[model samples]
Target: MKDWPGPVSTCWNHWIAVPTGDQAGVMEVLSLSSPTPITFAEAQEVIDADAHGNPDDRHHLSRVFVTPEVDSWTLVIGAWCNPCDSERHEDVLRLCKALSARYGGAQAYYYGEQGDGSAWLVAEHGSVVRRYAATGELDDELLTLGDPLPQEQARRLELGLPADGDPQAASSEQIEEWTWAAFHLAPEIAAAYGVSPFTLTREAKVRGTGVLALTPDAASHGI
Candidate 1:
């Protein structure tokens, strides 16, 4: 059997982290003049330096690996999780919008579903492209902007299989199968997004597109 690569958190999803301080937090993903992107060590320092005792409120950070066209840095935050709360889901959707507005892209991948109902979000150039259920089904109508950009379409076709075809028609089994295949190809997808596959697989790459593509072990430490 080909063993899957890494921790469940980083291994299976893409993510980003930002401060919870509203505008201040918003600036982290975007700045007026395009400030220098934060390094992985800098992001990690922030995470390690966080004094918050609560796991959910803790600051977890990861370097986004992406092409230069997509400005701004991305990190995966460790916010509190409230299962079955539509309000919580809305809160995240709002954040996704904010990231899209300020920067050009952002995304979040919950470590696991647990009480939460879904796990992935794709936002770009100030709008949400799609949202997916925990089982990888793109069923939620919570935020559907209709017709993603050409770049978004290309990336979706490349990275998100099965679910991307017709999220509404995807079954749980199909979603699971896609997840398995996607995770196994995480390194290849990461490379397509710009980072080298070998570098990402070895955890040597620090930057990547926010949840667009990622190293399998990217979220392991912060989570």
Candidate 2:
């Protein structure tokens, strides 16, 4: 195990689950088409009206980047809110579902910011399969969420997290280098989500350990 890197900035934590594929694999399936840009006048006005604008700043729906080491794609949306905001949460879900549908119903990952309590969700089509909330609340409504392997479950059991606690605290225990967790996505499920399970697993192994999963068994029950 490597030394714990002090404390992380909880103001913006990331949560993501891509079609069981490497960065390239997931990226290939995802629609990376840039969000329609605002008209030049509107963009300039928004930037100028806000005293905070810098000459280089521009308005956009979200900013995107790839973590090749983790085999996931991340998007930093302009919307910001606390975990308890139902409106924000719903908006996020809608966005995630749309993203998933773009890839022919493949599973999509969403990592939303909520100050020190970020949230992550894995969705197929419009249905949420797995949810990991950092707001000290456990979401068990989605039973279709997949299962973790024995080793994954056992490691989660060892964490012994507290009720009404942040799942990331438990996550810190399992991380080595940059890895969080990786779940074995089933082939059929992957197909439903329009992805290849074989490629997902292959990419995960090749990427080392930046990927991770928080199943209902571990994330909700802390088992």
Among these predictions, the greatest lDDT belongs to 1
TM-score of each: 0.41, 0.34
- Residue-wise C-alpha lDDT for candidate 2, range 130-159, written one tens digit per residue: 443333334422322344423334544554
Q: How well does model 1 score by local distance difference test?
A: 0.38
**Tens-digit lDDT track of model 1 for 55-173:** 35323222222221121232443332211124345656666677766666556544332322334455676677755433333544444345543433454456444323465666676
Residue pairs that clash (backbone atoms under 3 angstroms), model 2: 20-200, 21-200, 106-193, 157-223, 179-209, 181-211, 181-212, 181-213, 182-212
Global lDDT of each candidate = 0.38, 0.33
Off by over 4 Å in 1: 1-14, 17-72, 80-87, 113-118, 136-164, 167-223
RMSD per candidate (Å) reads: 11.1, 14.9
Distance from true position, residue 143, model 1, in Å?
A: 7.6
TM-score, structure 1 vs. true = 0.41
Candidate 2 local lDDT, residue 196: 29
